[model samples]
Target: MAKITFHGAAGTVTGSKYLIEAGQAKVLVDCGLFQGMKQLRLLNWKQLPFAASSVDAVVLTHAHIDHIGFLPRFVRDGFRRKVVCTPATKELAKLLLLDSAKNQKRDAAYLNRKHLTKHSPALPLYDVKDARRALHRLKAVARGEWHELSDPIWVRFHDAGHLLGSNMIEMEIRDRDPPLRLLFSGDVGRYDAPLYFDPSPPPPCDYLICESTYGDRDHPDEDVLEILAEKVNQAYARGGVMLFAAFAVGRSQQLIYLLQVLMHEGRIPKIPIFLDSPMAVDATRIFRTFSKDHDLSEGELAPPNSVLDGPNVELVREHNRSKQLNNVKGPAVIISSSGMMTGGRILFHLKRRLPDPKNTILLGGYMAAGTRGRDLQRGRPTIRIHGWDVPVRAAIDSVSGLSGHAGRSELLRWLKDLPKPKKTFITHGEPDSAESFAAALRDQYQFETVIPQLGESFELGE
Candidate 1:
């Protein structure tokens, strides 16, 4: 029997790690960092319950920090094995890991300089050197092809349609009769979503592990173009900078394209649109490089007529330019990263703009619990940032239909056609979300489901 363990993303939406063991071979599905609450974030620093050296390989789902952020630390902890992923994921992972290291170092230095951190030195978890070391081990394999992880075990990738090169993992173990099959739904994507293809239909399997990020809710049934146009016009009318806290990889590119479409259609006047995250600038380029493989049309990614390369769009890469955005005036849009306001340049923008009534802070996507973005979404009076409780005077608005994760109904749709598995483990969400999805499956399809707890283990087949 093969044993599977939930190391992260078991009871929360962030930090996604799973370990699968078969005899002498051990394969980790994803090595992600825990984010959001201090309790979860603290887990990132704790020694992994299992020996890092014991794991033979790490197979990635995508390049999102929450899903693939802990590689440097894992390497530091003595994991000296191939980190496998799709070709596009390999490119994005390098960019993200390097940026993650830089961001940690910068944040740590800032905390130390201001005497804000409890740790005397306030060092980064792992530095750029560590990140580089981890990158050396990354090996890219194309989608739809089987690659052996070790003896008695093989794996394949299928497009998840979540991000630039996201995928779901399928693993086949040779020990069992008919070969025990397992599928890992790596952050299922929304159907008919812009810029990416719909998630591939799940193939038959004995067991399935799925994400429940939006398990309890469905996205609003509204046109994203209409909602975005309205939000943009309102922000412009207020005569202040319209700040968007977006995920650099996907949401930032999507917003730029939609905004460009609005201007082209004369729905909203042409305005200065600045992408203020250096990592975002790089990621956008990577998106262009692989645009042909995605669902975006030629004009959406190609230069000259490219949606992301509109006349009013500006890519801010230098640190000085990002800082200058703090002084940006009204009738302008500045998009920054760390989507949930956990870290990155978004903090500086929030501190400068959150107290201005004329400014509008648009939350473009999901905001995990304990994040400053969640506080803003809930209309909290004050947000504690960098040791200060910044008052919330800005108009807080959110646009639905932009989240990358599949919602309750969509998740059901993704699984409805597949044969019932021996068991389905609902994970990668908050406790309530996991439980609610589990209940829905039982009621609607009578599928056996389990809400795995952190560090929980299970035997797949006899």
Candidate 2:
């Protein structure tokens, strides 16, 4: 009988991995690195329970680090099969993986230099060479088409609408008497979100694996533009920089577009906008390259006088130039990654700006627990950065509608049209969020729901 195992993201919001075994064919879905919290991050260093080479292929659902970040490490660990994803995901994955490798190396060197690491000599999880090697294995396929993985095993991708290239995976096992159809909801996106279409409806499946990142809560009923305009005006009036900690790929681009829209509408002043992450700069280019992948019209994405590009905007790619931003004054907007403030160019900006009461730090999306972003949201007096306590004197604010993940109602809406699966496994959320979501599904739709623990396995068919 076919079986499946939850490798990661079973009881947590990050590190998504699932293993499916059918006959002799094994396909691993969404191999990603665990982020947030020391315990979870340590999982990245431990060897996988299953042999990497034993897996025939690795299929991806999106380009988010938590969904696709571990590709280089997986490749480095001896997985030789192709990594299948949408064409946009294939392109974005390369940028993300390379940036992840670079960050790993830089962080390790920093820790080693400061003697802060537990290891005698800190080492990166994988280097750029490993990332490059992984990139060579990426195979892009058009969305909504069935592709054979092995004999009697096939997979299809449907737009998840979480990011530009995000997708939901529909897998079919033909070897069974009745083909076992399974659907994996890869970070379902918000309904009617900007720059992306609504999530594709779930195909009928016997089993369903879904994410519950915001399962326990819903976003506030506030216009995103009005909220952003208010924040920008407040920050500008204070005469200090408004720093945005955003995800490099989706969030960064969204903020840029929205800021432009606000400026054009005369809702907010046209302040100098700085994109300070190299990965974001490149990811924005990719966003422009794949205009059809997103909901933006040709006019919105078009060049020279595009809404995505403006005269006041600057893309900072050089290290020295990024440092120069420390001198950049207020009435300006600075966007950097990582969104959770776990790591990235955002840290540098936070260190420089967090101590100034006049400065405003805007969190663009959901901040996972155990991250600096969450700490700030919780009203922590100080944040630890580079082994020093940085006072949290800056005004902290968040936009209600900026999150990419579907909230409780939206998640239900996304699943409202689907036929109840025989069993629905809830993964990719904190214990409370996942349980809440599972209970809601059971009560509302009569779904046989299970919140699988990490490393748990279940039989697919009787």
Candidate 3:
């Protein structure tokens, strides 16, 4: 029998870790960081649910901090096993984890200096050394190849299309006496997302685990390109800078692609665009390395001096260059990372740009509750950043349809593509979203579905 447990991201949007045990060999999937509320955030420093040394291996879905953030902690806690993922994920994870470590150190130092943290000394969850140790355990794998885990189980990865190296995992297990197959839809990507190919539909399986981040709601079907063009035009008209808090991995690349297309079509004025995050700039290079993973045609790949290379576009790779952006006069566009405004260069941009009534803060993805981005989205008049309360007079706008995750309709459609599984477990969302998705599956798909609570475990096969 194979036992599966939901440790994190079972009833919440962050902290995405899952434990799977097949006899003596135990595999952990996606050891992500806990984010948002203080209660949940504290979990990051708490003891892991299970003994890290006992875990034989870890299977990663992608490089997003929410999905891969806690790896360094795992290593620090004694997880000596291989952390397996696609080559692209490995490259991207390195950049992201390093940036995460740097940010943690910076935040901790700031908190201590300002006496803003409740903790006495103000410590980072994990240090750069821990992150580097975790990198030592990383093992790269290719898509479509089945890798044997044990006598009873084998695993394969399919292109998830969520990001450059994202994947949906399939595990075929021998049922002691009868065979069974299990599939884990790590984080499904949108079908029409720019720069990426569509998510692959896996073959039939006996049991399935899927994400429901947007399961309860449908994203507006508006054209993001058109909306972005209008927003840019307005920002330009106001003669103020446009600050975009974009997730570096997928969202930043998608926005750049859309901006390129709009610029090519002459839909928006040719204004200077600055990509300020060094991590984001590195991620863009990684994306270019895996162009075959995207849906772009050969022609799209070879465009001369394209948006990425446009004369007006500047790639800010140095800290000094990024800081210089704060001093530049407005009507230009700036895209930076730490999408939720939780941390990163975006905070510096916001601190400088948010007080200007003529400027705009463009939110390019989902913002969890309690995050600074969410506050801005709700029209909060003032926000605290880097230990200082700053007035929020700038225009806050969101381009929602650009999300990487599929919405309610798209998820159901993807579900329908699969042959009916004997059991389906809905997870990786807030409680309301998971429950809502479970209800929909029961009502629309007529499938047996369960929303597993944290620490809940179930044995598959009889």
Candidate 4:
């Protein structure tokens, strides 16, 4: 018999981990980090529910930070097994994990230096050395092939369309007369999103685990291009700065692509766009390298050069150069990372620009609770960050269509072809969203649905 456990992302939108044990073999799917809420972020400091050394392997579904950020910590605690993922995901994970470690180390140092930490000396969750060690364990597996693990356990990756190399994980424990199959939806990507292919139909499964980030809500019925042009033009006409908080991985690339296309079509005039966050600059190169992942055809506007050549996008890397951007008082667009405004250079930009009523803050994706992005979306008067509460005077807005994760309708469309599993566990959303979606699955589709609690476990029965 095989049992599954939800270690994280059970009742929240971040820190995704699912432990599956079949027979004598134990493996984890998506070792991720808890983000947004400080209480959740502190959970990263706690010991993992399962022994790191006991798991035979980790099958990574993709390379988004929320999906794979805890890897360095897991590896540091003696996980010696192979880290399996797609080739593109492996490459991107290296960039993301190292960047995460680097940022954490810097944060810890800043906290210790300022005497802001409770500990005598603050320490990062995992250092660059640990990230590199985790990178060393990555074993790239091609999509669509059933890779064997133990005697009766096997797994496969399907196109998820969420990010450059995202996939839907399918694991089968071939023990009983008909092997018990399990499907894990790794941030189901929307169909026809810019710079990416549509999510593929899932393979058959006896059980299903899926995300509900946008399960209870549908995206606003507005043309994203029109909205972008209006916002950009508004910022430009007012001679004000336009700041964007975007995810370094999927959301960053999507924003750049949209800007490129908008410029090409003359929908919006090209402005001086600054691509802050070194991780985003690096991720753009990877997106260009993996051209086949996107929906672009031959000679369609690609990333890197596409964004650089057309939009006059400048890469902000050096500390001094980034600092200079704070003095940028013009009709320009500044794109920064850490989408939820949790931490990163985005904080610096928000601090400098939030008080300016003329400026605009464009949020690109879903912001979890306790994040500054969510606060801005909720029209908070001020956002507290790093011991400072910055007053919000900037015009805060969000473009719904640019989100990498699928909304309610698209998620249901993805579920259309799926075989009626014996049970469906809805996770990776807030409690209300998860419970609502669970009810929807049960009422509308007649599927046996469950909203798993954090640390909840269930045995797969035949």
Candidate 5:
């Protein structure tokens, strides 16, 4: 019998691990970390339900830490098998994992010095060396091609359009009488999103697992360009600085494209723009290399007016240059990463800018409940950063339309393209979002959908 288990990301947006046990082989999918609240974060340090060393392989869906975060710890725990992913995903994963490890170590050291941690000595979840070890086991594969895992199992990846190399995976398990096909939608991307192509729906499968990060709500389809232009104008008019907290992968690039368009149209006043995160700068180069993944027009990529080049844009690739940004006075835009205010250079920018009413913090992605971004969004008057209480006097705004995840309508439309799935599992969101989506599927499509609990397993075919 073939059985599937939900390890993480079952009823929450962070941590995405799933286990598949078929015949004599054991395969794991997406060994990711649980992020957000303290309760959920504590789960990251807990032991896995199954022996990590016993798992023969891991199939990665993308490079996002939420989807691939726990890998180093998995490797550290004694899993010595190949971790499979797309080539671009492998590259991006290397960057993300190393960055994550660095952040953990930095946070640990800071906490220990400040005596803020409950533990006697703060410790990183994993170190840079652990991340390096994880990278050695990564095996790159191309999209749209099927590779045999064992006699009964074959896997293929379809472009998910969420990030540069994100994918929706399909696995064909042959332990049943006629074999059962399972599809795992990693993280569906928004339709008609700039730069990237829309997610391609895959062939029909017997079982389906989909994410519902934006299931409970639909984003307003306002003129994002106009809104951005107006915000820029208002900030510049007041001699205020605009700080954008963006995900290094999708959100940062989208902001760059939109800002370029607004600049071209002369909608906003000219101000110096800085791309401050070294990782984001490196990610931009990778994005340029993977132009095939984006929907950039021939004109957009041609000559002097490429999105990467603009009148007042500066790429801060050095530490000194980044620190120099703090000294610049008035009417400037700075974009940085670790979108959720979880960890990154963005925190430093926030610490420096949050106390000034002449500055604005623009959030360009979803912020989990326990994150500083969420606290700001919820109107918290004061936020603690680096163990210091920082007053949030600056204006905070969110561009809701720029999310990379698909909304409820888009997810339903994608599902309608496939034949009726025998069984469906809804995951990768808060409990409300997942349950709401599952209910909608049951009511509207009459499909057998269930929100599986963590460590719960289901036996496939009799």
Candidate 6:
């Protein structure tokens, strides 16, 4: 009988891995890292319940760290099969994984230098070499093509529109009497989000595993682009830099596009903008390469790109160049990564800019628990960085309706379009959020719904 297991992201918002076993083969989906709360972060060091080397193959739904961050460790532990993903996913995952490894190395060095722990010197979970080796295994597959992972199991990718190459995956385990069909929603993106096409319609399925990141709440009713323009104008008035803590991959690019749109409409004054994170710079290039994957009209993303290459956009990829941003006279905008301020160029930017009252720190996207972004969102008095507390004297703001994840109504709407599923598993959310979403699904449909626990298993072929 075919079976599936939830190894991670069962009751949490990050560390998403799902295992499927059928016809004498094992497949893992979304080998991700655990972020946020200390307990979850510690899991990155724990041994997997199953040997990584035993898995036959892995199919990734997207390139976000929370979705593909653990590939290096998995490769180091002996996973050798092809890492199947869309061509764009393959490109972006390499950039993100390499950056993650560098951050890991830097973090370990900083921890060791401080003698912060009672145990031996800190060590990175995976290094750049590991990341490179993992990238070597990535096998690019085009969207909408069914790739055979095992003799009887086949998988296909449909655009999720959360990012350039994000996908909603469908798998058919042919060993079952009726060829049991299973669907995995990989962080469904917002409907009609700019720079991304709307998520594709959900296909028919016997069972569905879906994300519930924003389950109980809805975004405030407001025009997001107008709000963004107003925030930029506020930052301009300060005559100091506006620091944005953004994820290098999706959020950073979204902000860039939106800023360009505002500029074209003459909503905000022309101000120099710097994309200061190396990863964000690389991701921008990758995004440009995948123009066909987005919803841009013909010639819309043509040469001299109007979106990213607006009048005064700068790409800072070097350490020295990034440092120069601190010295640059402001009334400008600087977007840096390690979104949530976990670690990266954003820290340096924050340290230099957070002490001034004239600077505005715009927190973009969802800030996971235990992250500096979350603290900022809660309006904390001070932000701790590198073992020092920086008083939060700067203006703090967030632009709602910019999140990449789908909202409650959107998720329900996605489900509403499909035929009733035999079973539904709600995941990729906090316990409360997942449970709340599951209850709502039950109220709206007759499908048997559940909020699976970590390592929980279910037999799909009965």
Q: Which lDDT tens digits does candidate 5 get at residues 276-339?
A: 8878778877877787777764224324235567768898878788888899777999999879
Ranking by lDDT: 2, 1, 6, 4, 5, 3
Q: List the residue pairs that clash in candidate 2.
A: none
Tell me which residue pairs clash in candidate 6. Answer: none
lDDT of all predictions = 0.89, 0.90, 0.85, 0.87, 0.85, 0.88
Candidates in order, TM-scores: namely 0.97, 0.98, 0.96, 0.97, 0.96, 0.97
Query: In candidate 1, which residue ranges exceed 4 Å CA deviation?
Result: 297-307
C-alpha RMSD values across all candidates: 1.5, 1.5, 1.7, 1.7, 1.7, 1.7
Candidates 2 and 3: which is better by lDDT? 2
Which stretches of candidate 2 lie above 4 Å from their native place? 297-307
How big is the positional error of residue 318 in model 3, measured in Å on the Cα after superposition?
2.1
lDDT of 4 by residue, 1-462 (tens): 899999988998889999999888988999999998789989999998778999898998899888899999999998999989999999899899999999999999988988888987989999999999999999999999999866578999999988888899999998787788999999998777777789999888889998999989888777777787787888787778999999888787777777777777777777888989788888878877787676753125644345345538888889889999998887888999789887899999999999999999998778899989999999999988778889999888778888888988888889987779999999999988888888888887898998888899999975
- Displacement of residue 333 (Cα, Å) in model 2 is 0.3
The digit string of per-residue lDDT tens for model 2 on 91-155 reads 99989999999999999999999988889899999999999999999899988899988766799
Winner on lDDT between 3 and 4 is: 4
**Best prediction by lDDT:** 2
Worst 10 residues of 4 by lDDT: 296-305
lDDT of 5: 0.85
Model 6 C-alpha lDDT per residue in residues 1-462, reported as the tens digit of each score: 888999889889999999999878999999999999889999989999999989999999999999999999999999999889999999999899998999999989888899865558889999999999999999999888889998688999999979889999999988756788999999898876877888899999999999999987767766778889889998899899899988898888888887877776688988899999888888888988887766543123324344578659998888999988889778999999888899998998999999999999998677899999999999999999988999999999998767888888889988897888889999999988888889989898766798999989998857
**Please, what are the lDDT tens digits per residue for candidate 1 over residues 1-462?**
799999999999999999999878999999898989889989999998889999899999999998889999999999999999998999999889998899999999999999998998988889999999999999999999999997678999999989989999999998766988999999999887767899999999999999999999999887877888899999999999999999988899888887887787788989999999888888888888887656654123334335478678899988898888888887899999889998988999999999999999999677899998888988899999899999999999988778898989999999999999999999999999999999999999889999999999999898
Clashes (candidate 6): 0
